[model samples]
Target: MTATSASTTSAGPAGVDVAQFADVTASDASLRRFLHGLPGVDQVGCEARAAGLGTRSIKTTAKAQALDLAIRMVDLTTLEGMDTPGKVRALASKAMRPDPADPTCPAAAAVCVYPDMVATAKDALGDSGVHVAAVATAFPSGRAALDIKLADTRDAVEAGADEIDMVIDRGAFLTGRYLQVFEEIVAVREACARPDGTAAHLKVIFETGELQTYDNVRRASWLAMMAGGDFIKTSTGKVQPAATLPVTLVMLEAVRDFRAQTGRMVGVKPAGGIRTAKDAIKYLVMVNEVVGQDWLDPDWFRFGASTLLNDLLMQRTKMTTGRYSGPDYFTLD
Candidate 1:
């Protein structure tokens, strides 16, 4: 590999040691509470658990709270901003509909929306405690100029996005220009800052699956963290193999190690392709096993899922009320 000079020379500032951040302990009650508070997760995650048991494949790993926490870690929200204006209006209307069993619940994080719809989300969430996140930096491609990217981020924040997700140019990162990616992330992170000087949380999407290997994943994770990624996300869910376990495992370890070295608590977001309760739980178990549990909170973890919420609600209904519900009961529409 191409070991660039700046990455070697820059060790970050005083007490802000990136190397000391990954050592935090895992497993805790706080993480548990944060996850259980979420609205949906039963459709796929719990369905996976039930399906596995029905087939007698494996039923021993059912840690409800852990699984629940995993489900809660999910951002059951969606992307209404990508589609046409008609689609956006339809989705906004769907957001207004109430579920008899599940109701309109707050997701793990705010739904990721286009900048124009930020106000709709803010009004929809209405201080419900769920974050209102927006994608910035020429999302899904990030091929725009830096100034435009920064302007987009500012607009989203002004429109009421609580978190801003910015994409780095994969072209630059892949060609071995680590500094370019680093500078862009730092600039975008700065762009996300609030008026009080405290920046809105920034989740940097590495689109790890697009990268070649685990080593590249590790390297990119390091670069993003070093540049100030509040959360290291896996994909935009726009690409294939969005949130594979192996890739997520690598990211989890990177965060764990980073914490051990820097004392900073960076979060991990395994977005895209995660559809079931079992998948959600596996992610949780992996986090507990690999990162130790301290990273389980919504603050340190989140799943970008449009389908997971239904599965979670179904499971809860089955356990409490003992009946399976239709998908219509859980979906946004």
Candidate 2:
């Protein structure tokens, strides 16, 4: 979709300031009209562009640099029903020192876990550069009441989470209750605030797989950005077809257009289905070509991954030794 300069920074559709869009939650029709009016996605064209970007050749020193950058941009994630204190600690350690054998490897951007594990993760990552991120708002399914969702967010923030990855109410969104979804995000964003005056950054997940169309992905991206999302994430990593290149491409285009219009930069995270160093580099290539060098840093981009870090470390090891290493050589996440 196209974003006009007047539409970006100062006000979104119908004179709503994107930086402070929480005011528009009163009307669903206004939000719906604004979202549906965004540029339609050409699915074939979008997929072709993603495939073309996937073919980029990165090797030698360039590959090495990409590997390190990808590592630093990872949100080393461990979201499972059986997640435990020990598992969170081990993952937190991995986030801090991805490659225990190599002191030079930088830490992952954050450690993403369930809200219940936020305190454990925060304590485990004490004094480390890595941030603690917790998934909230009923997590994979946004089927709970607004008060419950806000409570979920507050619990994580109170537990010392630095970031909150929240899933939107997909049922409401798909049913065309756009304002309901928007207000939910605004409420969650408010709950991210702490008594100390600092606030946890909010990453809103669209679960593109369920959205089922590039048009919906584009619309959702803009909706979240306008609603004050710090980052617009592709998927929850629990759904099928999570984090595909085409979905991510649509998001990157949205962010680029959004920034051009409002001068506000929103981060993008492609969670799920992204494995291997090659896949990670392909995504990085797409980001560079689509969003440009401005989003290359971890602060503006992230990969929500659990096993992806080990693969990156393995590739980084190969780049250093000129020989491929086995999975055993790297610590399991």
RMSD of each: 10.4, 3.6
Off by over 4 Å in 1: 1-62, 80-107
The lDDT of each candidate is 0.68, 0.87
lDDT of 1 by residue, 1-333 (tens): 122343433333222233322221012232223223323323355345434433332233364565456555765445644555555444443333323444533335446677777777777667557677788888888899999999999999888888888887989878766666767887787777677656678899988778866666766777787677889999988988787777777677778876775567789998898877767777777777678768878888998877776676666556555577777666552
- Local accuracy of candidate 2 as per-residue lDDT tens digits, 1-333: 234444444532223354454334437766777788888999899999999999998878898899999999999999999999999999988889888888999889999999999999999999997999999999898888889989999999899999999999888889998887887787788788777666898999999989978999998998888778889998898899999998999999999998887678999999998889999999999999999999999999999988898889988988798888887988776
TM-score each candidate: 0.77, 0.93
- Which portions of model 2 miss their true places by more than 4 Å? 1-26
Top-TM-score structure, candidate number:
2
